[model samples]
Target: MASEPESDAFHEAVPLAELEAEGRALVAVEGVPVALFHHEGEIRAVNNRCPHMGFPLTEGSVDEGVLTCHWHHARFELSCGDTFDPWADDVDTYPTEVREGVVHVNPTPRRSDPPAVHWRERLDDGLEQNLRLVLAKSAVALQDVGVDPAETVETGVLFGTRYREGGWSSGLTILVALANRLDDLDDEDRKRALYQGLTEVTSDCADQPPKFDQEEFAARDVPFERLESWFRENVEVRDADGAERTLRTAVAAGATPEQLTGMLVAAATDHRYLDTGHTFDYVNKATEALDLIGWDHEAAADVLASLVRGLASADRAEERSSWRQPVDLAAMCDETFDRLDDLVAEGEGKEWKRPDGFTDRLHAADPEEVFDALEGAIEDGATVEQLARAVAYAAGRRVALFATNNEFSDWNTVHHTFTFANAVHRAAQRTETTELYRGVFDAAVNVYLDRFLNTPPAPEPSPDPDADPDEELEGLLTCFETQGRVNRAGAHAAHYLDGGGDPERLKAELGSALVREDTGFHTFQAYEAACRQFDLREDAAERRDLLVAAARYLSAHYPTRREREGTFSIAARLLDGERVHGADAGSDAEVATGDD
Candidate 1:
């Protein structure tokens, strides 16, 4: 019986004789139920409830100085009440004393620090150890206490740059981008972004040595025009070092991110979306990240440097003859904007209009018709806001239906296009960037034009309003995980939601199914885009529409062929032939005799 003091707070829990008779006794002291155990002539007291699932510890079995919860079999040391399993946190133990052959417990248990404080300490530990789950838990807990996500991001950014010798990477780029978009997000999203950034930075820096700082570019006085040209020329020539030097030189000369934004955007768009839209998207995201980080000139330089890598390896779709000839796409795009300017001026006093069937036309996947419908809506007093929504919806359709091979890394294709459209939509919420919306719309038209590549076209979605969503969800998960039914998964989700299924539950399940395994970059982008789309859940019909589109896009390029043609068949024949020949003495002779 270990006791601190026989203060007035101590209350008689049970008679020592009764505890010994039953081996354990549950007693209420100051409204707190405590379980007193009599083992080896010693009295020990702990909380009556198991911390893991609230199972009564009084029913737990004590053996070899350990108390085991029968509910989940979680074990704890009775003496100190330390949980053997990490999932079950340590139980609270009360100081007990056998005074006058009676068990007395200090009903008032020792108070632990606040949850936020505890989680913050855990966050520090997680960062130190680069532990993923701990970092994730800490981020969620910190956000629950209304802590700013920027703080967590700063921690990760500092840790990553300090530890990772490779300078900047895609993870860092994305983390920076997420940080830039953090303030605009809801609490859950902010926390998730923080967790993602922390995890990425930690993972990227883990086991890597610190990088030596680069020698400062001495040509700080170089003209901005010349530096800009040098950066583009270096990126064009795949001179990564030269490109980085140019960016660093420009930054060293006191170039603000706004001042340098034009150069990066120019380099990106100068070559018609350097990598099937991904280059432009990356530039945009990196710019957004720079804006969010707020005045870290070194990080700006690092971001631009990493972007040059993408610029170098990116397959420029602009260079392709398919994009250039017959259409004069630039002229058409300019003409649409010119008309848009005229319409905006004409509809100054008129209320913003939404023509019926506008969404249907977009979902029909006819680019020319979509443009026609859009132009009509503009003529009918549609505002820039309306156009933005229309274009965003169109973009979601592309995300739902875009498909391509792994060789070309079509995932990025889908992601870049979706993100580009999404960015345009977000921009629309604040300003009237009509030209940007047109650009997004024009790029989306190209996505529609490339639909033939989606061999074994996506199956049409049947809107079963009276179906069992839970049953559909089961199949959706199975197909998504095992059979690569990406599009079908979206369709199933739509069906599940239409059948009165819980949106959050389905979203969670969809998220789990999509990311249950190790996924590629495109998968992550697509899912993130999906989450953004789902978050705008005003209408269930629109949600179903978006999901159906996603399913179609995902399913279009199924029965994927990552290997060369006949590779598996040739290997199988060789393996089978060798095994048969080894087992049968004259298998080749029998084949030859049969042929004769």
Candidate 2:
């Protein structure tokens, strides 16, 4: 028999005789399955769920003062429930006592600190151990307390930068990409978004050797001009160490964010749309990470050093025949790049009045005509950001109108142009450097070159005023479940946007749809680029186009094997303390698969 305690929290666990005779008992405390142990002349209670996979703890053996789970051999110090195996994590132990021949246990475990504070520490632990469950738990709790999402992003940024000798990685890039799109998602999805990004970053740094620090030159008095030249020179020759040192020196000399951006943007363009424009996009993302993490010398050094490898090792577009054979586009760029400075001087501090119907002209098939159009705009005093935005929108159109007849992999071709244009747009906004004008022109040329991919473009979808927004969105996601639904998916999302549907809901749904699939780095880049460009566009038609581009791209890649997301789901369930295994869970089990 069991007796109740005066405090509601202390539920009568079991009779002293009953618990002692068996040495352990399973009881429900506050509906949480709890395991009670009579060991080492003491009575102890812990949650019956195993911290690793939710195995039944009462069914396991107890020796001395330690409790061992038979499922995974996870050993816990029964008194405090601290696990000897860190991967299992510490279990929650309840306050226990014996009164009047009856055992009593508090359903509410003792707490020495606030959840926000504790989880904040746990976030570091999760990152340290690359433990997805701990990261998910900390993210959920921290978001509940309204902790700024940037703080969590910063943790990943620092960890990612320090652990991988490669410096910045696609992991950090993906993390910052989601961080960029956070506000576009619904409140709850924001937490899930951060968790997803953090998990990727963790996976990136796991088991990798730590990065060695790069010190700046002893003289902080060096001029930015000299350092910029040195940095570009080193990158031009693929000298990674020299480039990193030069960049660190610039940071130490108090280079403004714009100045630093100018250096990378200039170097990225020094090689004719370096690496099919990924070089520029990565520069923009690394710059964005600085926005979330910080721009101080220490933060700058840790994050920016990775770019040396990215830039020094990146494939130069001019080296590829594709840029040369058809249009001699690289030669055309070289001709303009020679006088690029003069052209930039003409455009500085002047208002850009787009020539009539100029947007349509940017995608003109004649490479010469495209160059003339861009030079016309630049010579008319189009600002760098203005040029970037124009080029990005044109690139967006390239994607929005991307043809389905093309082989599936070619989706990346137009995507490359659009995302590169978007990066140039973002970086252009950050600096007044004329160097990005070359980046802008480079993007436009790529867009023009990519026009073939979208030739005889798919008929654009229009808003159906009568269609239900919710149903349309649901159908939009459903498009991913089947094969070759690319164009139809685009139509669904575009129509939903113009039909007075909530953009945030669409974005959240789109984001959820993306994270659900086994997506890759470029997929993330495409999704975020669309969201960002969507934010920058005021034209109703353009907004609709951005949505269409993202939907088409995601549809093209959707319903992946999804094995990766499944892992994250199980980890999330464990963090929520759900019993995933053991007899108490029974044959009928609801598998948890992420933040729902």
Candidate 3:
């Protein structure tokens, strides 16, 4: 707000004799719209515009001490402009005094405290009422006051556990998982992660009161094997209490993160890509994030505990043909891992070359051809870096190839695969790349699992490759932000080629877009992997092929429900509050309802 001027501090409006009792008047004092009300033997003034909407408050009905905006029926106290409805923010009140018969109003309202304090209050109101806008403001403003982002995370976690029914969910899982990764990220990314964590939890718990779950851990000294059995049984039965107790018991008994991870993965894999692979991915990522932040088993106990419900909620894959069919995919994955080991050994003395066709073979997607290419690349002396890149791209392809026409909850199918592959790719950075091959093999299994989804694969690039590179690149980016459809991306590629845009430039553009549109941890990992591959400045054609794979993968899996009018609207509104963006429409789905 601008400072009050020395001159014309108070502007006189209508006289008291001319004003009618129990009436509202709209008057402009020093160019500020003020709603003056003659009610209950005194005069009160507030901003003319309703806080809920831009509707004029002068047109609203006033009774006793309350003023109601007719537009949304949001009520505010007459003098203070404090709203009764949480969604509707408080309207600014102006100081007013009547000297004799003349009405005077101060255009510049008095400020009693800093914005941080006010925003904090608004945040509390938001949390209490589940107002997303206020939630966003408070989260952002809290940091401005030197408040730690972790506090926000803790706040969100408490809110989620205390309010949401059915206990933990993917939403809460996302929150807890991101909380573990906060320290490893840059300042900006940390803020985003924190904001995402808080918003996800609030969104998850919104509209639902907490359902208390009884805690029941085994009291007897149980063997590790017995406890694992008991834990799996409890998880299978959706017994959150028993599972939590079993997990805590293991942690307390000096269980390694690896052991806990093994147990979770066992429960997860027992379901054959549980929840379209999200359960295992969440389990894996949460565990990995703990490792990245140097958090021990004690810290990770809660992380896994939060996921018990999500794991229990999943429909197990043991009954599917993917597991029980003539060709056992799970066993095949084991064999592939074995082959990967032998191939890594075989490539020891061989000179390395970039496997340009690796992604192509994965896309061409004859299971045998792709498998052979994986082994052949190793024989041709593919470096750990090259192999890791190819495997991660292949993982992304699994996500892209997923059918989008399924039920809303099924969208996690693609999301889990992509994010899981991303998690593996990132984890490979710190650990030896050889171990991450299991991730490659797992991604391959998912590719095989989802083969039925992509009845028709992604279309190849245009034969006549001649187009304006700049314009085509722009079109492609526009399509990513707007439509995010496969056909549109293909068309843009064709136009770019038709206009003489080379594969190299197109890849660079795609990489830049991936970096810009990085939605979360997995997206960031994909972009980072691309940067590392390209930072070497080798393999132009290989880079182009990889970019094409990315384009195809993105095409297959874009315009996602994740970016729909739901949660994005809250984010958008927050940005709008900063005057940096515009408002968006609300979503039919609740916040954190199947939101990744």
Residue-wise C-alpha lDDT for candidate 1, range 193-255, written one tens digit per residue: 666666666777778887544444887788888888888898788776777777878877887
- Candidate 1: TM-score? 0.54
Candidate 3 local Cα displacement, residue 230, angstroms: 8.1
lDDT of 3 by residue, 309-427 (tens): 77888865545776657666666656666577788888888887655455667655456666677667777777645665666666555444444454434434544565555544444
lDDT of each: 0.61, 0.82, 0.60
Clashing pairs in 2: 569-593
lDDT of each residue in 367-411, candidate 2, tens digit only: 888888888788779888888898898998888888889988888
Return the top candidate by lDDT: 2
**Segments of candidate 1 deviating more than 4 angstroms:** 1-150, 157-169, 172-197, 203-270, 283-315, 325-388, 399-412, 430-438, 453-457, 469-475, 478-481, 485-488, 512-516, 536-540, 549-596
Candidate structures ordered by TM-score, highest first: 2, 3, 1
The better-scoring model by lDDT among 1 and 3 is 1
Least lDDT summed over 10 consecutive residues: which range in candidate 2?
587-596
